[model samples]
Target: MDHAPQLIQERSAPPATLVIFGASGDLTRRKLLPAVDNLARHGRLPDQFALVGVARTPMSDEQFAESALGGKSLLDKRQLAGGVRYVAGGYDDPETYKRLAETLDELDAVRGTSGNRLFYLSTPAGAFEPVINGLAGAGLNQATETSFARLVIEKPYGRDLATARELDGVVHGAFEEHQVFRIDHYLGKDTVQNVLALRFANSIFQPIWDRSWIDHVQITVAETLGVGTRGGFYEGAGAMRDIVQNHVLQVLALALMEPPVSFEGENLRNEKVKLLQAIRLPTDRDVSEAAVRGQYTRGGTREELMAGYREEVGVDPLSRTETYAAMRLNVDNWRWAGVPFYVRTGKRLPARLTEVALQFQRPPHLPIPADQLTELDADALILRIQPNEGISLRFGAKVPGHSFRVRTASMNFSYDQTFVEESPEAYERLLLDALIGDASLFIRSDEVQQSWRIVDPIIEHWERDRSPIPSYEAASWGPTDADRLIGRNGRKWRNAS
Candidate 1:
C-alpha cells in the first residue's frame, strides 16, 4: 500500500540584511527578487530581516522598491517591499563603501537584524575584487561578537587556473574560507540534490555503482537559444569556461563523489573536493583525441532563420570561439579507475536539457537466442535535471506472447506528478542556504582550483591551435567530430531528440 508523504518543516533564517551588489541589473530583477519573494511566501524569512540594494544607478529607497516589485503584489507586500533600501555608488569607490557601511548599521539598529549580513556579489566577475576589498575596508567583512557576516559569489569564478588561484587569494584576504559561499545555482536544483539521495539513501543501487557494473556515465547541459545580445560575453567565455568549468564539472563531482560521513557542510564539500581531485588531467595528445569543440552555423526553417555564431552582433566576423564542447574524462580512483565519464554542453542545440546518465554493463549471458534478443541493449539510469525533472530507468522486458522476444522498457518518476508542493527555484534554495550558513551545496576553494586543473590543458591546447573549429547546424545535435570522440570507444551519445 502507498503511504502519504511526510511533511518536514524548515526553520526560518536568522535576522539579517541581504546586500545585493548588482541590484540594478537584470539578474536581480529576474532571479534574485523573485527568489526572495518566494522565500517570504514559504515562511522561510525572518521578521527582522532587511534588504539593501547597492548599484551605481541613482535611485531613492522608494524608487528601488517600486522597481523591484515590478507592479506585482507579493505575499508579504508590506514587509518585503517596505524593508528595501538603496545606495547608489561605484564598486571601487571608497565613498561608496562608506555609504554602504552606514546603511547597514542603520538597518541593523532599526530592523533588529543583529549585524548579520549576507553580501551577494551579483555583479560581473571583474568587480569581485573591488567588492571584496570594499567590504573589508568598510569593516563590513568582520562579524561582531554577537553577529555573523558572509559573502555569496556568483560564477564564471575565473577564466583559467592561474586567474582562479589569484581570485582565491583576493577573496581569502578579506574573508575566511568558512565565511565565503561560492554559489553555483546548478547545485541547488532539487534533481541535482537527489543524486546523493538516490545513491546514499537507497541501498539497492550502492553495491553496483562502480567500475565493475557501470560501463560509463554521461553528463549533458544543452541549450537551444543562441547568444542573443550576450554575444560579447560568449566570445570571451565560450562553452568551456561558461558551462563546463563550473556547472558541468560540479554536477559530475556530485554524481560521482563517495558518500560523506554526514550530509553536513564540511563532510559533503570534502567528498566533492576529493572526487574532483581524482579526475585525470588530460595531456596534449589526450586533448586532441578526447576533446571536441564546435560552433553553430546558420540553419533552421525558413520561417525561423537562425544566424551563425560568427554573424552574431558583437562577435568577430571570423570568430574561432566554440558554441559546443564535448569531452571524455577518466577518474583515476579505486571505485571508478577504469570507467569513463562523458560530459558535453552547448548553445543552439535541439533542446534545452540537462541530465546525468549511467549505462550499466550488459548481462554476461542472455540465455535467449541472439536473433530474438536483437532489441536488447545495456540498461541505463537517467537523472533529468531540468525541463522535465525526473528519474528514468531503462531495461529489457519481454515482448508479450510467443518466441520469448524482449525489448527495452522504462520505469519513470516525475517530480511534478509525485510531489504535492512545487520545488523552489534554484536561487531561492541557494539564498536561503547562504543566510542559514549552510555550505553543503556551495563550492569550496579547492574544488574550484581542481576543476580548473582538469580542464586547463584542453583550453590551452585549443587556444594555441588557430585552425578553424568544426561547425554544426543551428538545430542539430552537434558536430560530427563529437560523435567520433565517443565512437572511438564503441559508444554513442544518448539521443535526446
Candidate 2:
C-alpha cells in the first residue's frame, strides 16, 4: 500500500483585469504590485491578464509602470508592467468612474480580459462608499452573463461594529455577498492555513483537541519595529482595532473552528462564522478583568534609543492609544468550553513573531516520582506563523543521565528545511485567490460582524474610562498588567524567544 502524498495542482486564474483604486498608496507599492508580479512569474496569472491603476495622482501609463516596477529589471515584472494602465481621478467623482469604465473596456479589447473585473479598494476607508457608488453609477458592478465582477476591500473594515455594518450595507449595495471579498491578509499566510490542515487532516490530534485534553491556546502577533511614520494612522487605530479585531480574531476562529464538510469557500467561511459566534462576548466586568492595554515607552538599548508612542510624529503628547493589547477570550461551545484563548499583539516588542500555541493538559497521573518530574513541562503544540515559520511540539522527555529526571524537549519542523518551494507572501496568495474567485481565505460578512460584536463592548468600556493607559518598555514583552491579565487565570504570556 502506497502512503505517499499526492500532488494537487492549483488552476491558474482566468483572464481578468484587476483595477486598484489606491495605486499610489504605500500598500500598492510594497505589496499589491509586487504580489501581482510574483503571480505572473509563477505562471499563476492568466496570459490575458491586465492591470488598471486608479489614483488621484495624475500620471501616464508609462510613468505608473515605472513607479510600480521601482526600477526592478526583472523580465516578468517588466512584462507585467507592459500591460499596466493608469487612470487619474478622484474616488468620489462620478467622472472618475466614467473614465475607469472606459479604461476597463479598452483593456478588454486590447488585453483580452473578457470583461471579467476585480475591483480592489486599497484607498482610504472614507473612499470605500464613494468608490462603490461610483462603480454602481458607471454600471461597472453589473457583470455580463459570461463574466464575473468582484470587489476586494482592505481592512480597518470599519471603526467599530456599527460602522462595519454600515460599510457592509454600502458594499452590498453595489455587489452581492459572493462578489465581495473582505481581504484579511493573515488568512493567506501558509502557517495560518496550516491550522485547518493540521487539525482536520491528522487523525491523531482530533480526539484530544477539545477541552478534555487541551488546557488553553495562545495567539501572539508581536512586532519589533515601532509605528514610525504610520503613527498618524496608528493613532486612530490602536492595537485592538488594527490587529485584534481582524487578524488576531481571524486566526482564533481558524484554530477553534469545526471541521468543514469541504474546503469550498462558503463551507469554510460558514464554519469560521459559527466558531466566532460561539465566542463569549465581554461584558463590563469581563473587560475590566480579562483585558489589558499599554503604550510603548522609550526603553531600548542606549545605542538604539527609541521614541515613546506619545513622542512619535503626528501623535498627541497625551495620547491614550494603546500600542499593545492583551485579552483572554472564551468559546462557549462544547469543544472549547472552559478553555481560555489568550491573544496579544504589540509593536516594538522583544521579537517579531506570530504564532498560535496550544498547551495540553498535564497527565492526570504520572508513574514517576513527583521530584523526578519537577522539571517537566506541559506538552504544547505550537504553530509558528511568521519569522521562522514552522511547527514545534514540546514535551517532557527523560534526561540522558542515571537519574530519572525529565525535561522539556522539542520536535521541530521548519518550512524552509522541509519544503524546497518557498511560501508565497500573504498578499500574493490572497491576490491570486481573489483573482481565481476563491473566497475561502477571504472574510465573510457574518465573520466580520461577529468579530466586531466580540470586541465592541471592550472598546466601549475602555473609551468610557479616562484612566491613563499602562506603559511598557519599548523592547519588553508588555506591561506588567498584561502579565496580570493572563496571570489571573494561572497562565502567562508565552515569550517569543
RMSD list, candidates in order? 2.1, 1.8
> In candidate 1, which residue pairs get closer than 3 Å at backbone N, Cα or C atoms, i.e. clash?
none
Residue ranges of candidate 2 with Cα displaced over 4 Å: 1-7, 73-78
Q: For candidate 2, which ten residues in a row score worst on lDDT?
A: 70-79
Position 23, candidate 2: lDDT: 97
For residues 237-288, what per-residue lDDT tens digits would candidate 2 score against the true structure? Answer: 9999999999999999888999899999999999999999899888897798
Candidate 2 clashes between residue pairs 3 or more apart in a chain or in different chains: none
> What TM-score does candidate 1 get on C-alpha atoms?
0.97
Judged by whole-model lDDT over C-alpha atoms, candidate 1 comes out at 0.92
Model 2 gets an lDDT of 0.90
> How does each model score on TM-score?
0.97, 0.97
TM-score of 2: 0.97
Error of 2 at 170 (Å): 0.9
Candidate 1 per-residue C-alpha lDDT over 173-259 given as tens digits, one digit per residue, 9 for 90 to 100: 999999999999999899999999899999999998999999999999999999999999999999999999999999998889999
Error of 1 at 486 (Å): 0.6
